[model samples]
Target: MTSNSPDRPATAHPGTPVRGRAHPPRHRQGPSPEEGELLRPLTRRQIADRMGELGELYTRTTPSGRRKPPSGRPFSSDPSALLAPSPQARSAAFLRRLAEHMRRPGFELLVAEATRPSGATVLTACAYGFPVLGDDTWWQELDGHLPANLPDLAAPGGLFVIGDILVERRVRTQDQSRDWNLARRLQKRLLSDHTAAVGVTLVDRGDTDTVAALLSWGWRCLPSADRRLLVLR
Candidate 1:
């Protein structure tokens, strides 16, 4: 599914077709809190499928013209990339929809971003009872530098051990072999320490390999899911 409308001016008529805006912001009405909890403990494949659906929804509603390649293929520098009227709205809606989907189950949402604004938006959503974890330069840091200060998610009874967890790992570049390796290692470590449900969001600029590697690490692949995680090298 994809959207083809253009960006709407801030003061445009309410009835105007907004480029990336969902008619009612799906989160406004989603699964009840109890249902969210029930959905929280879903398998990796389930979570991926859910996220994929949200992504499809975003693409469906986002104007094709706005899908421009990044300058020099660099990560988008504009904060609006994560929340503006075009792609931002779709992205925000994706987060909101995910939150709503997990709201009923009280699943904790962990979003890791390469940029500050993306993390901020995810954290903001997390503040509403969703569990959020983030790192600035997360991709760079995860590539080779494992943080000594990293939280002990594996600690028994730690905050990291939450039923139904969503971990978003956003990638902006193609040279992510080291990062993928580290992420797989970390996932192995986390699985050993915690029994809570876990899922990952391998957000990429366009390189499917990045997402593919992440999924192949341990996450059960779901054809129904849109994102593909490749096995880390």
Candidate 2:
């Protein structure tokens, strides 16, 4: 949704190297270890238990790859700053929204995990959403007229709202670029149960990068007066 940005985190390019961490040596001998495997959908309780870790993932994968320092302090130079958890207030607010959304009927949450060669499982990506009810309530939020064909997609069996999709950052090389595709898979898994339903989400009007990425992924933009309304059939 526009309030949350796009499904995928609008972060640094996954292929960019972070200043503090050393890139793991790649083993071209077999499949890459960073490739994520979809996990079973999570329940609200499971999400509660892992909220801290999820918050870190959200912070680390943000546009700057680090949290903003409080108003009076200078940015930290500590190497660990690159992997620091999100600021408490911001993280709490984000988790609150996730929890609130989970309360909606038909809500579904999916997370993808990848294993390091060292055998540690890491959160790779996440996506969650619910079916939109067959009513005019949701459409009334927009300022302009809806596209003619769009309403058909929102009929009884046709619309699913993709609340958010988040992906973690990883150092990458040409041969181990698989981590970048995790967002797509998370979304695909999110929609797997809703056969023939069109997926819809919103993005901030100024978020050109996200809009470009969605367009590249085959989602088309529907005309809207303010925020962008994107749909995937």
Candidate 2 lDDT by residue in tens digits, 120-186 = 9878767788877657466776665577766777677578888776654332113322434565666
What 10-residue stretch in candidate 1 is worst by lDDT? 121-130
The lDDT values for all models are: 0.36, 0.67
Model 1: per-residue lDDT, tens digit, 122-224? Answer: 2101111222244323224234333332323313222232222222333212222432433333443443334433433334335444345444444533221
Where's the lowest-lDDT run of ten residues in candidate 2? 170-179
Distance from true location, Cα of 176 in model 2, Å: 14
TM-score for every candidate vs. truth? 0.27, 0.67
Alpha-carbon RMSD of each model: 20.1, 15.8
Clashes of each: 19, 1
The local lDDT score (0 to 100) that residue 159 gets in candidate 1 is: 24
